[model samples]
Target: MVDTKLKFGVHIRRAADKAAKMTTALSRLMANTRGPRASRRRVLMSVVHSILLYGVEVWADSLSIAYHRKRLAAVQRRCALRVACAYRTVSHEAVMVVAGAIPIHLLAKERKEVYQKKGQPGTRATKKEESREETLGRWQEEWDAAQKGQWTKRLIPRLGPWLGRSQGEVDFFLTQLLTGHGAFRAYLHKMGRARSPMCLHCGDAQDDACHTFFVCERWAGWRRAVEDELGRLQPETLVLKMIESDRNWKRVATFARAVLSEKRMELASQGPASHEGTSSSEED
Candidate 1:
């Protein structure tokens, strides 16, 4: 599917369209409010991504163009959002991280590298693993340097350990904590949907992710319960602690769900008048 200019734009667009349809067909399984997130991620990678990247090695170099990269990325972003149970407004980088999925461009490059090494002495599995490690390393470096999603970065400073977790699940509430794009007051103010960024429960400080999770006196009892079992909760070491064991992960997740659920209910009870100046546009 090459153009007169010998560009792979047609192929890329066709692949993206097919993948988008496949994603929609499988929407029930990958819907944010239903099904196991891990299973949804598997379906996305095996079905949607396979269709999108079919024979990617042949046209991998075309991904160097930003337009081509974004075309494919948009498809992957939709699937990742569902896998992470994240809001649509979440940044691509942050949602991909929370979803434990690699970037589409990097994956295409990895496949290309693996295909190039097919004739080498090593087995294909080993070559693919090597390419995956290289791609993940590159992604980690980019994540560290990214300026957007600072809230997510604070929680998950390293992507490797978070991706390797065998337990715990990424549901909507947990995604809210990780991405800081949920029903938080500060986030609402940024979107022009709230009059003040002050905490709805405490009314003393701006209700951002960090303040809600670690500093808010309103949730002091909940935090104390979690800290009693998980030792101490620090933003820098939170992910590490969560991934340490299934008990630790569930404990933290439960705390987030309890607190954030109440917060959501509180905000809803305030009625539409509380959000009088709601904006149609939202920033990443």
Candidate 2:
């Protein structure tokens, strides 16, 4: 078992090493771009690097876990070293800085135009045949589209940077925003869809995302304690404020996802019952 694990480690290391070599190539392509010629290759490389780093950061902990047992520790260590080396070449911070600093919309436009022009006969239909510029442009579109309907856009700034994440990560966050975070609660309330935006768990008057996750009664005593700790280091954006205010944000987000997951969970469980209860009390 140990020998097999060791061999697997060797294989993984070689693969990571190859990725690092490719990352260097990306760096060179980025550097090689010059004036007015529209450096599509450079832009593509940046997007690729960001995605690579995002995956590495997310799995870094799990990857380390494999090292916990003696049978796999050596392989884990080797893989870790290879990952560390690759990241050193193209750090997550660097990728974030580049992503944040650039005008993503404009870059996306450039990429689209480049791809449209490159569509010619005798060319391979595979997406790989498309220029690097087009690929990143598509990614930008996806990120923007993901942000469109839901409310996370208003909340993420306060939430702080989601370090080492790709545009794909936005989908999970978006799911939280629309369903679990209850950002949609207000919309539902406005449409007379929900019984109340107030916390059923805590009976707090203001039951937005913060109240539901941090100040609500539903979480038992633990949520409030976590909220107090977060309040001390409140984030800048409202959405992120809720996220950062809790040490259990990830856990809570998962719960929120579960709660919001069912189309009628809130409606069937809390909505009609609370609405009727309120009406009966009013009549009395």
Residue 20 lDDT (model 1):
91
How does each model score on lDDT? 0.81, 0.36
Q: How many backbone collisions does model 2 have?
A: 8
Segments of candidate 2 deviating more than 4 angstroms: 1-108, 112-151, 158-174, 178-185, 220-252, 258-267, 271-284
C-alpha lDDT (0 to 100) for residue 86 of candidate 1: 79
RMSD of each: 2.6, 19.5
Best-fitting candidate, scored by TM-score = 1
What shift in Å separates residue 95 of candidate 1 from its native position after superposition? Answer: 0.4
Where in model 1 is the C-alpha error above 4 Å? 1-7, 62-67, 273-281
Query: TM-score for every candidate vs. truth?
Result: 0.92, 0.33
lDDT of 2 by residue, 1-284 (tens): 66755654554455445545555554443321122111233344454334333323222333332342232222222222122211112222222222232222333333344455555654544433454445445444544555332333334421125422322222222233322222334334543556565555555655554454434455435444444554432223333433343433554444444434432344456646333111110100
**Weakest lDDT window of 10 consecutive positions for candidate 2:** 275-284
Residue 242 of model 2, lDDT score: 39
